[model samples]
Target: MFHQPNSEFAVVCRFQGLFPDDIGGYEKHRTRNGGDLGHVDASRSHLNRRVIGNADWAARTIAMIEDMKAENFADEIETLTRRRRKKQLKHRMVEGPRDPWRATRHGPMREVILTANRNWFDAPATSAARAARAQAFEDAARDWLLANFGEDVVHARADLDEQAFHIHAVIVPKVQVELNGTTRWMLQPSKHDLIKNYEAAQDSVGQHFAPLGLARGERRAAAVRKARQTGDEPPAYRQHVRTADWRKAEDTKIVETRAELEQRAEAMIVDEIVLAQREAGMIARENAIEVREQAAAGRERAAETKEQEADAMLAVGQGLAAGAFDIEDRDGTPALVETPEAKPGLLSKLRARMALSSSGRARALHVFSKALARLRKQSRDEAKTAVARDTAEIEAADEKIVEIASRLPDAERRSIGKIRLSLSARIMALTGRNMARETPERGGNDGRP
Candidate 1:
């Protein structure tokens, strides 16, 4: 059901093309990975690798090595990957020592990293069990990297401590001729390209277990959705960056906009005043007649009612009345206060507020119970949301990885690469012909897709 794994782990891989001795090249490339995050190599392999059984030993070895050397892979790989859709921009994260410090660099070193990870993980039952699981993942990762990139990977090993598990690979680009005497350009795959290959490898791994009734695809999908909603996320700047200044700027813009609006309102008011001026005389004459008629109607009502409630009079023609009536009197009561009584503190003359009346106290407990129930419900909702987020992220990562991998060049799919090239050439040739046939007055556009 799946073409690749939606793994809840991050992996890194680096590759360097071999240099011939005749080219005045040295062993610098072999030692490059060792210098990367040195702590990874400092661990005693005998003890760590022994933690896992033979069945998972290879998996554990690779995971540990990858974790150690990940730093050398590249910085801000996830950021770069996310920005890929922008098309026009290459996400280059500028880092290093601040103004005063800088690290030494040998040769013109450049690298692109491809990282794969899900946001959630399976919990361990015991320390030994956790160690065994870790060992298995690392071991498998080691073999995976060598098998995909080549056996020459033994020359590189990075030490990232235990911060994360990722592979580091290095390859210096140079031209070389194959046995067929065809000279080819040496190059490191782009980040997008490398991830494609990695995902393809994972697809192969998943299929091998299919006959054993192990279905990886479905499990990965469910786990990914669960991880996404649980907030088991990779580090993202949205969580860390503050937008207060942006909001403040937006408020200022609104204030300025309101000032302009006020000017517009003043103009509108003036126009309204002018319009009223044009209609004022006719409007006043009509209103006067209305008032006179209303007055006559009110007098008729007053004469009819007599003295039952002397101060009351019937409403006249919807507030067009000219006749006045007496106001009611409630002269003895104290005037009502508009302000609330303030609570006193310290040595103020006002008496203290009682902690609570018996009924008030009982009501307070009822309110507390309601609040507690609400809080519990809120907590459950939050937990559910977090789990869903984690799950989504994992699913997205898996699908993207698989799609890229399916397009990569693998052992059985090497011929697929030729197919891609042939198709691309045919497409380009047809496109050129179409463009040539089109009128110059018309232009190409994005609606094509």
Candidate 2:
């Protein structure tokens, strides 16, 4: 009923202890809590299908080993004890009751792990195809066990619940012994020595599966011979690493690596934000410096203009002091002359002095008015600049708040949004106050000149 296995596939046959004392925990794990193991996916446990064998490993062991022992060996043991008593009475010899099938040295059961190459079954993914492959393997393995070990194979189970489909066959090692006028089967693991003849067992199983293209693994003897030829020691047999432990370690590494990556990413983000803030601060400082330079240049220009006006007023006063009028003959008529060197008459001097005083007062008054206007304009410009800078900073803060709020939970985001709105309102009020204060109507500066 089994399909031909791919030639590339190989079979695995491992023998290990499955003692009577270990059966309770083993049965619970295999039957009930298999999903709790690392290799098993609890969510896909529904896909796990049992091929054969009952859940009561303990009962099965008792029935096959202890019960059989009591049934067949009880009378023989009693008779042997009676004989031993008579022998002890006749001779000075140490005699004890015969317990031939005692299980003191070795347990009654040993487990065999049987499976084809894992890839053969796992390659096919579709439900029907995968099921067929699993069924074929199970059937072949079951038949092989029955043919090779007979009734000694007390329990056979195929587990499709782990990483791969495999079969566990429980075998009781026993042999027929002829002694003390009776023939009986007795527990004798040392005589059978299945674990000692592991290579032979693998070879036998491999031969059975040869028609299906399954091949045996390399022999230890062959490996030893090869090692001798190469002038090296024979390789030591290594124990199988548990799939659960391997997977757990790998998962832990993956989690740790992922967490490290996340932390690095967060750190990078924070660094970029800090850099951007620093750049913004630099830009603001540069802008303020430019504004101050511009205001200073304006003040310098105003000072130069005032100096020139003062010089012009002084020149007028000097001309008025020199003379008010100059007399010169032109076409035989008398003409008044105004010059720096011309001497003034008493009446002319009086007129010039009165005129100079009146002009001086007006010029001084005009200069004072112009200076006041310039000062007022400078103050207004400074106030406007301050208001603009504050407004820009407030807007920037609002934008930052919005960006941060976007990452928060809905409730927290809503609360932050309310705060942002209040901040915006306050900013608006501040802007209004700045604007009102800067206005001429607020009496900050009136352009009287």
Candidate 3:
């Protein structure tokens, strides 16, 4: 699923070291009990004006995920991000073969990085699992980017630090590169069109004014035919044209109407792209939650075991000392003497007496059971919370997709004027992956593959 980014977000792929750190780094603290904490600037670093008008799906999704992890919890489980305010979670900026932060001090160095950074308060609980998942994710992302963009991606790295997890991609050339005769992008390159310049360039986009060798209306007719058959809107490539109106539009009414239509069309195109991106992210979040649930279940069990052991020791101690359980005993209690039942063994009588007098044998067992139950409840609660959060995020992703597609095309999309809701639906399917779940199709979507 495409990551749901706040309106505060902007896509930042060509980050030249300075931009990313400036926008979204962990806040630094002074001392143990310092003054106000410092935070990273989140202002637009894209250096593009039009992108400011629209938003990028992936960047927004990543931003939301990180912010969610950084929130504070008053009761129950607390995230490390909360424990130490202003201190950004540990981010691994280590340089390695696949690391994105590689340096070329002198000569000439240029590379691409598809990096991701987000804090997860609880890592030890599912470190192994996350690591495994990340490994697989990296491999898949690498292949996916290469396939979508180009094959010039020389290096790819995906890993996690204790506080925040991230991915790094290093490509030799720029994202939009000259491949053979055409151009290609890396890491959701189509998304690159979301850049400010690209959006502006599209504002006045039009054909070369001269008619092509082929029939002018053929493609447009095909688009109309598809729309009629499927009962859906026309695709982005074929839009409503002004063959008749443009010829005689000197009145203010015609001019105003044309301008309004153009703006609406651009808005629609932007919305559709964003919508698809979000749905893809939704599917991915659900999967992450399920994995978290299993991990939480395991931790809950371990914690319960420890609490039980503590109870057992406390119980036996209390029993021996007549409800005065002294933990710091010089020598642990030995069984006391009672009636010699048939004199089965030398210590049988003593063991029996101790067991009878302590009154703890039974009570201790009960205490252990109670402790286990409490811990189990805590663990289950944590799992439920995780699932709840995951559900909300996933649902939001779905909604965002709908809202984006529902928008009418505007001037920003002058050339195509409008993007097909169907195209966005198709791409949103693969956004956040290896995750699961389905949401209601917004508007009047059929929800087909």
Candidate 4:
């Protein structure tokens, strides 16, 4: 029941007026207790009355009417006096009626009551949330009145004590009239000009409450008007009314047999299966494209890693070559021999002279041996670290290449296989060179004699 469209249950009433006596009676019913049908309901009534432009109901209603009448009288008198002066200046007779305000009666005060059907508020049962929504609806309605009528709405109230929650807004109809070349406020007899069309008022109300789940009710009059304008026949449903008994009887009949229902279900299933298959194929193609992209990226990363490893290996080799020296003869034949210097530096001469003392020479040799041993150990550790780093990088590159090959298509896989073979050969060559460098005997007489 709550899921049904609210447009069918929405309500917006037209502006209706009340005379002075009627206003007095309504005030009595609202402010005081009288009967069960009165405005007050002791069992279910809640009143949130407010005065918008006056101190109380009397000032807003009866007193406001008297003040407007007095203003109208003064305006009429001013108009007459101006006309008499104009006639005298033109030398024409001013013989119109002297008492324009004598029998003029101020019209009834207009009020529009907006409320929805009872089922709307009662559907969720009586709860704090439901009450809050009802209050919000009333506030929205009041805002609508203030926006459309501005200061004309003198008083407004929301009465929740009745069967259906509703809002009552009293509007004082006043318009500006020109009197003796000066504009003055005068009481309007009716709100006909203000509310020229019922449809527009309904639309305004709908717009104000639309956010609160209140939709504009379907206007049959508008549909009829449209039909006449377009020269089309009115819908048959509008002319026909189905009785409750007939509707109930029709609902009781079985619409489809079990066999037919099964056939319809099977057809629906087949349609769904076809749609699912198409969607699955599209998904597969998209996934294939994504996998290919991932594989390509993996291959690029692996190639970059391989290049980094090669650069590291080259740097290590250069560092080792710079630290070590190759001794060769004048004819370019490898040799190792000592050559005497022409003179000794001051520090070397002092050290040679001190060698005659046994303790000094022993201490100097001991320090030199320790220093050399430290240098050799540091170099070996650095070389081992560099080799380990390169090995890790090469392994990572191989893993990436393998992963890419696994995901690639058959044709692409063959191309990757060839690249893998080339990379494996390069790796083997680098490993063999490193092994030969580590084992001096394996290098033979290449650089040493």
The best candidate in terms of TM-score: 2
Off by over 4 Å in 3: 1-14, 17-110, 115-117, 120-124, 159-163, 174-449
Residue 212 Cα positional deviation in candidate 1, in Å, after optimal superposition: 14
Q: TM-score of each candidate? A: 0.23, 0.48, 0.18, 0.43
The positional error of residue 406 in candidate 4, measured at the CA in angstroms, is 99
Query: What order do you get sorting by TM-score, best first?
Result: 2, 4, 1, 3
> Model 4: residues >4 Å from true position, as ranges?
1-5, 32-40, 46-48, 51-55, 78-108, 179-184, 189-194, 230-449
Residue 446 of model 2 has an lDDT of 23
Residue by residue across 247-366, what tens digits does model 4's lDDT show? 445544533343355456777885776687679979989999998999899889967664544333232222222322222333533232211321235334433444344433332232
Where does candidate 2 have its weakest 10-residue lDDT segment? 89-98
lDDT of 2 by residue, 1-449 (tens): 34465568888887766566567666666666533476765676575555445656558765455434433433453344446654432221111112246555446457878887677777776878878877777778888877777777767777776778888877777777776676666766556544558777878888877765678766777788899999999989766665667787898899677656655677778577668768987997999999899989988996766555444444333332344322233454322335444445644544444354453334533322232334356667778888888889988988999999999999999999998898799878979887776755312122111
At residue 153, candidate 1 shows an lDDT of 35
Using TM-score as the yardstick, the better of models 3 and 4 is 4
> Ten residues in a row with the worst lDDT in model 1?
316-325
Q: Which order, best to worst by lDDT?
A: 2, 4, 1, 3
* lDDT for residue 184 in candidate 3, whole number 0-100: 30
The digit string of per-residue lDDT tens for model 1 on 189-299 reads 332233336345446444443332223332344455667888685333232221245555677899677656655677778577557755985797899899899989987
Error of 4 at 203 (Å): 0.7
Pairs of residues at least 3 apart in sequence or in different chains that clash in candidate 4: 44-161, 45-161, 46-161
Which portions of model 1 miss their true places by more than 4 Å?
1-122, 152-160, 171-449
- Of the candidates shown, which would achieve the greatest lDDT relative to the real structure? 2
